[model samples]
Target: MSGFSSFWASQNKVFRISIILLLLASITYGQGNRKPFAIEGKLNLTSWDIDQNPIELNGDWFFYWNQILTPQDGLLSFNQENKNIKSFPGLWTDYEGDTSYPSFGFASYLLIIEGLEKDKEYALKVPDMYCSYQLWVGSKLVASNGKIGRDAESYEPEWRPVTVNFVAERETESILLNISNFDHSKGGIKNSIVLGPVEHLASQKTNEVAANLIRIIGIALISIISLAGFFLYSKKLFTYFSIFSILWSVRGIFSNMYLIYSWIPDFNWTLGTKIEYLTIYTSVLVGYHIFHNLFPNHSNKIISWASIFINSTFIIITLVSPAVMFTELLNIYFGLMGLLLAYILINVIQAYIYDEKGAGYLAVAITLIIILFFYDMLSYYKFLPYNPYITSIGYVILYGLLGYTLRYNQLHKSKDTTFKFS
Candidate 1:
């Protein structure tokens, strides 16, 4: 266990990156002008009605591969790419072209949106984008997010949504966006972008920030609760569960991309991600340890050692690999989860059938967890739209059940001695 703790301590170097992905919406085509290779999406400004809803900026935009430079970096390169266009709200890696997939470097997207009211305030909500990006409306640079490195060694992914508000200086605007992503497999705007009134954008930002704060506070409370149990019980199950709770609380802190990026704007998202995944893996390790302790007969030393070995190897691989490769192994994590749940289910049922104290609550808890795990797995595979962090919720219940079981066992032993002596 000491060695295991030391291994986790060594993973302090890991960081993570990802940003708030705005929901995808449909686009309505309207009158707009276009240039060769530039997307001419309709940025309708006719309606100021609060109920009018936002307009989705969709169409093919200029796409450059493995090159993140200033707009003037290529005096001749910009003009020559008249036919090179990639659709908006899609990754360049998925775009069909002469260029190969997974182009690992810098890229730029150029969109020319014409027909806008002069001197009117407008806001463009950037969707969850991979790696980093810089937005230039006309000749003025409006915003930049995360660290944009020229190459792999310099590249660290940190994701955050940014709202760019600008007054229409002219009736026509050419938006030049320089983006770079070496973190994930496909990189670009994965979510739909909204463009509309500045007020609406501000309201949206406020809601996002509020949600993040609430989530962090709630997770912090859970950690505190579990910590109290750990200290009061001084049992292995309670200690492991406490560690798991704290890890999840840490995950919640970094879960909201927008707030985190705001606080640590320049901090490496990759490092954050490493910490995130490390917590996840570590939780599972300690989780199995708790199970093995509670049901020692069902899981022996061999089973214990195997679980440790497998997770330890995965953690090492995760620390060394890029985000793209690591994501591919997520299914494996799911599979291991399924195995653990099956084992726990069997043992929990056996305990219940034998009339063990607190086994009933433990049974109910594990059953609910299995159901939540199923739903979360579906959400993970895009089978469901709701991204329920059920694991966190499930663990909270499990921790409480274990606490009850520990106390119940102690009372059961005390009652037996009293009966025998009488």
Candidate 2:
């Protein structure tokens, strides 16, 4: 076999390598020579060119708060000399240094990038905002995610990355963002913003959206496989895991929700936010069942059932209530999460103390989860500088642990059965 394999490898290796290299070169050359679909701007936009090849638009900008102004406001009787926010990656949260920060109200940012070609095509690439915003390019409203409201029940969170395409109608233009936040723990922009040729940003976003879809679909597959686990092994934990993963994955659909919005143009984003929290609330309920089944001896069945009942009630209420009401319930849900986590930790500790089989591994995983959850929560609260992808990492750890536990239990049960039969 080795002699034949050696001959086969030697026979076509050079030819295969040559073909691959030729194809790669051809592809590279073709892409290099292709003309950009949108009009090209000079390299390096000194402002909000935050990060992009052939440049991004990021830098210092003028900012003001306490009002949700329109492009017309900036045009008619509006002062361009409003106090500078004095940041490259501008966010109203930066102003939180002052105790009087208007975190829950409206703020406007203004920047003008020049050296663009007249009548050429361009698009501003906007990342997720804390709550809502309206993007304006020289008095033209180009894009907005959710309706921006100035106060409590009026504010909503709808964050889907957008590429607002337009003709570079003039060489110099006003890039105005009327941003408001009342949903996130920390309100306002926290990342670099960009503006450039439509094709440059659009192509980059196409790749990003493709990745997001793949992630959602992968989780979707996991949910189906988990559901099938019940029939294969006849364990109730599989059912709980199925629901939990499905709920979490369904919530993730909002991240790439533009796909749905594209098909249903009139679809309101507030509905998406409601459904997001709905899934979140329900997922926590099912998560309790997972623990209840996994550690039936050490878990408190009454508390688990009560959690499910309460969460279910709220979810029903969310379905009927206005989206604003749903937003109001978030703090309560988080408080419940704290209580649930505390209760589960107590149960896990008891399981570990009693020397329950496999409890050690679960304890370790849960401990890591608690740490990461707190870190991520702190980051969310503006108490930390790190914006690491802790949630997804924590989920991966959880799913991996749950999968291993199921497999271990199955294997142990099968061995015991074989021994008894023998």
Candidate 3:
């Protein structure tokens, strides 16, 4: 077979594979649209009508403290030597007989009631408190919040209740509650926490005012900076693109925070919101412009090909996949960015190898930008504790580099003018 024919066959196969993958992703997304079960937030203890049977899980029994665990044979028993009874269902402050907050707090409850049923599903409803809380039914640790459940890690305080099914004893049962305050370092103060029964809300008034304030402040600051840039740079195409990028970024963050839809009641807010797409698109445009600026001559085919492939793949994957796929897609984007950065860095190094002037500083600046990008991605993925704002550090360095390049060009022009006069 001819070499051209072989190349054509290879290209055809690659094209077919790409088409198949796209189709598969689309199909998978479409098929996985089943509605998930809705779990209600925090339970209300008061006015809880027993639909099936009455299984009271609330009763005060005993208290104690122990760092190490030992076998015990009591319906209600814990280390009481650390006698310091704080408050319940909330931040425990103003404990009697204890000057400072106890290192740990544990309490058990025992209740005697005439109406009790067997083989009924019951749950211990604890108010959202400072740290972690554990519950025990008949000496068995039944339910735990912020420690045993997935909802524990999230700080969003919803009225979601934790349910645990228990086997009915021949007689009445004992319920124990153990709560631990993980840290008091940040001046742990008193807060509201209450155990309550479950009830449909009379109103679903989400607390969006605070979120709106944050969004407004963030967006306003970004807008001011963009406007200043327009004034400073004469509204050039690059400046405008950068402004749009930042506007989109602000919008994306705000929308993700649900500030836009929440504050603007008239606006139709959908469950599956893709408002962040605008931000992603604007970012790509800015990146494209940056690439053009970095490689003005467009002399390297490999760099151009690789960048196009990576960016095109990112755009397609992001558009087709749902938000849940963001974790996986973000990894792809991060990898692409890393490779593109390394490619640029290699070119910078090559420039220096050729004894090129001003290449050293450029190399350092590029390295810094790459490092910042990696750190920002890590932080975004929750792998690092660094601030998300770290990504903008690269933008600062980029602006400084552009200014230095412009000033150097002007100086070089002056040298040429002097030579001509001479």
Candidate 4:
């Protein structure tokens, strides 16, 4: 224990510094870095250059709760008394205005952009909303995702991030969106809708797609390598890690950019969502097994079995139930995962205390994973501001450390064998 204490004390500063740097990088990356935002459905960007900085169409937009208005209806046709202002990049459930808004409902969002050069080629980057949405630019229906309906039966949920290009016919433009949600727990535009020059938006979308592809490819490569390692070496650790990597890769396809749907346009939404949730639940389960295998003496058998039971139950629930029913279990699952990680960390510490091979590296990786996990959880619940692609950053760092640890262990084992023979 004294040895462990001294070792941790010596490395504490370095670890904290590394984590802080990572956190800062994650917070700052891909944040648009624009201060200008919409106010009461109007954004003035006369001075701003769209080519230089694509603005996130965030902030207060003219929200018509429970009313799905169209460009044909005219923005002014809505009841003045029912007019409400709601902030974007957030769910309607968070709205606290004239009337309380439920998670599942239909609404219209209107944002008027002023001070644009007439007839200039510009683009709007529309992210995947809660379920389905239709966008209109000055009475022209430019883009839509799935079919937006007032009720569940008529609603068809689809997730496809789109970049729509248009020529600014006038100096001011009215952007109207009719969005509906009945399939998911959260509704409304939760992600930023970006507005910028056509070329810039296209470049940005290309870069984003490229990054997501790289991440998915990297994870898939790890899984393949781990699987090969398992087959060659017949190690349980390799098998578990391979499963973890594979699950995350599938999750990456469904999440972030929803690349799978892009590749297969007719992919089922509910199935994709189910796979996403299953991957998360199973990845943690596999992660626990990895830790248990590393330091079996430190792992409690009863606790391990209990965890298995709980994760199995969650997996079963996800498979059998509707998306709405299974999605609500995420908060509870996050709490359980926190506890599970704590236990795993304690075992890793024990392994480190005994001077187990590669334990130090494992400890560092797990610590970072826990930090990122909490950050993601808080961001998901809106307790903290969310950062796009932050999880991918965390995964890159975590997997790098894990890969190094694996290599270190293998090298040391070979050396030990050679020494024994000598």
lDDT of 3 by residue, 335-401 (tens): 7666666666677677667744455666666677667767766544334543323443444545456
Candidate 2 weakest lDDT stretch, 10 residues: 413-422
| RMSD of candidate 2 to true structure, Å | 12.1
Model 4 lDDT tens row, 99-215: 777878998888888888888888999999889999998878888998899899998999989999988889988888899999887888877888888887788788778767666
The TM-score of candidate 2 is 0.63
Instruction: Write model 1 residue lDDT over 215-305, tens digit each, in one string.
Output: 5565566556656754665533455556766776676656544455678777677777677677778878877776665555556566678
lDDT of 2: 0.66
Once superposed on the true structure, which residue ranges of model 4 sit more than 4 Å away at CA?
1-34, 78-82, 367-397, 403-422
Question: Model 2: how far is 362 from its true place, Å?
Answer: 3.1
Task: Go through the candidates in order and give the clash count of each.
Answer: 15, 7, 17, 0
**Candidate 1 residue-wise lDDT at 291:** 64
Which lDDT tens digits does candidate 2 get at residues 198-251? Answer: 777787677656655655665667778888877887765667677877777777
Off by over 4 Å in 2: 1-72, 77-109, 112-123, 128-133, 146-159, 165-172, 178-192, 195-204, 255-259, 353-355, 364-397, 410-422
**What ranking of all candidate models by TM-score puts the best one first?**
4, 1, 2, 3
